[model samples]
Target chain A: MSFTRPDGRGNEDKRPLHIIYERLDRVDGSARFGFGDTKALASVSGPIEVRLAAEQPSKATFDVTVRPLSSLPGTESKALATSLRGLLSPSLILSRNPRTLLQLVVQSLTPSPIESYPPSLAAACINASSLALLNAGSIPMTGVVCAAGVALFRSTTEEDIPALVLDPSESESREAVGCGCFAFLFRTEIAGSQPLPTNDTPGARLVWTNWHVKDGTSDDGELARAQALGLAGAETIWRAIKQSVPQMDNLPPPPLPSRSTAGELGIITQSDEVSDQDMNDAKIEI
Target chain B: MALQTQTGTSTDLNAQIFQRLHPRAYLERFIKEDIRPDGREATEWRDLSVHVGSISTANGSALVRLGDTTVICGVKAEIAEPDLERPKEGFLVPNIDLPALCGPRFKPGPPSEEAQVLSDRLASTITAAGVLPLSALCIHPERAVWVLYVDATCINYDGNVFDAALIAMVAALKNTTLPTATFNEETGRTMCSRKLRKPLPLECLPVSYTFGVFDGTTVLADPAAFEEPLLDTSISIVLDEGGALLSAGQLGIADKDTMSMCVSAAKERLETYGREIYAFLE
Candidate 1:
């Protein structure tokens, strides 16, 4: 059989990402994030009075609800709510708005026909909700946290070794026996350090994860590799998110870093030293 | 605590009641004495009884009681156009109802997660078993065919509801009689004659056996969900009379030996109670 992804993208490549920041005026904050054909829009409304039944005693209550692309909500949607709520609870600097409620709604626009059975739209949901929460600007976060989706791919060769794919398209995700979603925080770096998302930032945290593979299958090695790739992909998206926000034109640029570590790390920023090769790497990686 | 009216979670309120009511610890103690609390061997099945053709309105109906669990399955057959993709085949739809009457845990609303899972499992098992040849229900090529709707309701919740549902479904299908249908070319409709009933083509018997691993090593046959819902491992296996595996569902990592033991026991049940389970159909 011919070795070709259904979307004709490389196994290691992520789908084209498009982010529409502050897309809705009515909501406190809103955004639309799309990875290939799967699109999700999220809106945040909160710092409002908490209902007695749903109140939190100490911290602001974070509620995440996912409405699927088609059909009424089912067990899968309920499960997604649980996972999203868990992730947002720790990420959302809720201590600032104690005795309040933060409601986030993520609406998936398309169902995955590519991964036909028991489809999941987790990656899209997380990204859109994160963007909306940031746009809301109601709560101060310690760091910018984002999520990335990764899948394990096997080659067509006689010896099929698993390869990791970041932000896999629906069809590419279909080929993966196992996949996971990873969330990480991008913390501010030292003036001349590695990059904005160096591997060991004090605040760089993994806030959420959901990973699974076929039962009784020996895919532990594959899962570990996929998780590592997922973290890298999350960093790439974190950089892209920072770049997407309208930059500070008035503030003086930080003194050109004594060393060009950002250029070598494939990050595109206000720094004028970004090389074409670095730009290409940034484009393809994110 | 009252055995019949006593509901779940209310047990939490009645702590002293649970001490006397639940024999789980007592059962474990009995195992040390080389006996089950119910006075049976580890592999011994609970007493089961089946009554077929009990519902007057349904074409086929059966009520099954295993130990304390009770399930009633009713199969209704109607003439309908066959699907375009499988014109020669009919259809079978299985739905399981977990109503509040069965227990306090189930609420009155849409189908619960447990119900949906059981419905899908029973449907897949029926399809894998080839319980009825779709071609046998065809009338006038693709114009009309018999569609069987098998619905099971849990009236009592003692335990092993899946086993009771599967047995009731098989019994109900066996009791079902196909009505005579003649296709008319003029109206493109089927005319049915209920009096001229005929038996459906049932070639093989598909049965399920459930086993639960208690305390990791001790395995109990037909374990009750009420007493021990969480276990180290729980497996349900469905097999046909031909010794071919039909369908299987497992919750946890069951040891290799435990799986094989359950399979061997299920095969034996296919010959013993599996065949005797249909005695009421005649």
Candidate 2:
């Protein structure tokens, strides 16, 4: 190969990943993600009152802005936001809230040259933002998922065949003509409990937030590999979502009418069930 | 105590009630005694402690406390072309902010005038005084120089912001170590890291002391939060350990006589503050 990375791993393999949640307090949800050298912080706020006129009626809008701390827009931030918006919107039940707006703000603190599937750092950003949304008690979605992209390109010369790149670094992406990205939304479900009614479990529904790739070159065979990678990525992220929303395990029971009414009081008298005092005692002992 | 329906203090109200109800009077009394009802001096600064190397990841960092005023200062340096006008010198940019959460009066937004003026003043004074050796910053002369960003933040405020900020900034610069840069002929790029052993070329430590002159008479050093609103005049002095004044200027309203008196007082204040700075080294 004319260009080989210092590390022996093929261009398709990703760098190691580190994901963090609840990085900021003022925002509804926030996260900081690092993939090798690249670092990104993502925060989400509001299904609150719509401050913008364009976002109203029949849809919960997604507003995303990427800020690069050191330099102006690099190739990675814009591509990451566009792909993340597509992947994340599907996971949100935005159609239910006609006029509400959900805001996503991602800041790239440090730019790393690493490129591979899902752009691990960007994926971390989205994941963190989604968790922040959950923390804010926004209505939940059906499942949680994240996405990544891979590119495959061929050289004009026959001797040098097409190459499969997992995630192309900024330099490499510019050099190649062919590129492909996958926006995967993993289905999220509470691990220990059956699916509850939407009204009861507001934080349980799955909402996809992040997509990342570490490093790779794009070649003809990239799609098949990315799809395969997507499935595994979805499973891992599903596990993460379940871990993030642990409150689903002990949901409050639907509120029941008290015996303040005469008719209800009679029913309470007739029943031989344990008294409130007994329940309180049991709770204290436990 | 009689409950008054009116929103403000009634002149006839009892002294106890008047003291309790009048924020303005409470502030005035606090300034008069140079001592808070809680027994702290108006000019008497709060207990100041400095922690160096707080930001382990940063090139140089320090956390400073002046009474209740808490500030964090971090120094980050990057290599770039020197400004065309000042090719022989490195660049220093100071950013000071009163993040909205710090006080109710501050609105959430961009830098306020107060913050802008402080940062600009600090930057200009340090540069004009030749505190940091600008010549040392020149890597390729006209082609490249180092830009040092001094990010200073006020985490908390009780009063006397300038002194706290200056202390934090100086401690951060003192704690800072330079980065190593190597030119790679193959790539024609210079890789930079925090491995350099040499200290940044420094000329002298410029220490700042701030005093508030109230009613054109009381020159209070390190005015607390309550005094800031009551005071009529304020001044900050940046000086070296050698007792040579580098920068002396006043804010708000004060006559030349009062200003000069405050300046002399500030000279004494710097000696006291300088002792604290030296102690931190130990």
Candidate 3:
């Protein structure tokens, strides 16, 4: 008997993909992407004058904002922003545009039910934000980046045979003893002068990796297997994004907001408690 | 940071020697004598100074200085509607601000990750401390309640802002005197007494002690700012005046000795917090 995943897909199968590009007109870039029930929207704006306090003299600043579908934004959102900033900052050549602020806003339109697979939401967010940044075109990039989530789950039929499931849902992640989120970037396309290490290896350069293993389960040989499996999953995602481009529609010009720019800020739509003062750089330090 | 830990000598020209000896060697030598770099014993703490009722404009305020680290706390009490879910319970909002004046790493914009973490920790700590019971804060149950917005600002950043913030907040809360509220039966509204005469009821005080571990085992209590980033592991333990462990934050897997040493250090310093606050109020 064969073991099937919660979503009824094969161990190596990806969820049905849906990516909407440049959803907004005026913003430099915007994208809405989903992997099954989990969905997120991302928008990129600027290379513009940053607020007085956050301005840097030699390099551009990255202001990453993440919004959830419900409840107040707290440490979790801040953590997401921090993680996303760390992941994306490396892929971007920020020195090109000095003394400017690039705002990256991500909104989780639907919450994934799989609590154990928290990285899946981040994977989707990372892909959506990267897609939006690409669409915006204003922000300089060194390489094309995409991320995928993978986990090891026990089969219902044999219990002992754990399957390495790609694009694991929250339910599948909870059942899996080990899980990982991996991101990749095409090396030849990015930066200058650092030649691809070798001809066979020019395939995919690892950009980011975050892995986890459930407690009580020892790490005998599963970590290496998870890493290889995650890298393969990331390669698959990178291929899909590359192939989808030829079939994708050309991005239309961004539309301008009818009202004042401040009224349309990402901050206003974030949470109920935030006021106009919050939009005008009210200190988060407090 | 790497230079301070070298024990074996002299080949590297850039290596920093502590008193002509390696830093790790200095630490090991001091440990035998039970002393530390700053001239204090392993369990000894730096000097602490507290000044209450310093900000006249605020309902209550205090400034706390723990060694070189400084924090000023202000409490503003105002009447506000109670939450629908828990109409009888009042609200308490504690925010910790880190301005540029505090350090070079922090900017003047929205709260950084450190500030947010500190703010959330202090808020929960204050609630857990049970310093102001919700029932007493309610002027009229389900109608209006006194909301205390406690804000702590770090003016100088040396080390251990969390402990200093909580201490300043405690001092400020003790110094606070609320105006007596009377229910006007005719108007069916609560009226505030012109003179601030009533004091909020006290519950329990929670004090936190932070320690840093070198390599992975040696526990150094009350680490200075420069020593924090270099630590392999660190732990902060919070205990109430009753000696119950309320909460703790730790990085990396801590050793058994580290936990025991931190708890004993916390217990030893618990009384000093109360004694100093009592002396200040008097």
Score chain B of each candidate by TM-score. 0.87, 0.84, 0.85
Evaluating just chain A, the predictions reach TM-scores of 0.75, 0.58, 0.76
Task: For model 1, name the residue pairs that clash.
Answer: none
Off by over 4 Å in 1: A1-286, B1-37, B279-282
In CAPRI terms, model 2 is classed as: incorrect
Top lDDT hit: 3
Give a tens-digit lDDT track for model 3, residues A1-286: 2567766788777776655563475678887666776668899998988998898888999999988777656765765676578667757889988889999999887664311126677688888888888778888787666778877655545746556778888777666655657666654544577764321334454445555443213223454455467667666555445433432344332232332432322112222224324423422311
Order of all candidates by lDDT, from best down to worst? 3, 1, 2
Give the C-alpha miss distance for residue A284 in model 2, angstroms: 87
lDDT of each: 0.67, 0.57, 0.68
> For model 2, how does the per-residue alpha-carbon lDDT over A1-286 read when each residue is reduced to its tens digit?
3445445546655444434443354777665444444556677876766766657677887777666655664334454554456556656778877777788887766554322222444555555555555555665575555433344445556566555565444445445443433334444355767764432312221222121111222221233444455444434444435433542222332233332322311211112124445434533542
Q: Which stretches of candidate 3 lie over 4 Å from their true place?
A: A1-72, A75-286, B1-35, B183-189, B271-282
Clashes of each: 0, 45, 12
The stretch of ten residues in a row with the least summed lDDT in candidate 1 chain B is B247-256
Per-prediction RMSD in angstroms?
10.8, 23.5, 13.8
> Compared with the true structure, what per-residue lDDT tens digits does model 1 show for residues A217-259?
3322443465467667676666556654542221334543333
Predicted candidate 3 versus true structure: per-residue lDDT over B1-282, tens digit per residue: 565444345456442445344555556666667777678776678788889889999889999998899999999998888989778887777888999989877888888897886776577556544667878888877788889989999999988888889988877888888998866657878888897677667665666788877666567778877556656565677666565655544443344345556766776776655445445464
- Candidate 1, residue A33: the lDDT equals 71
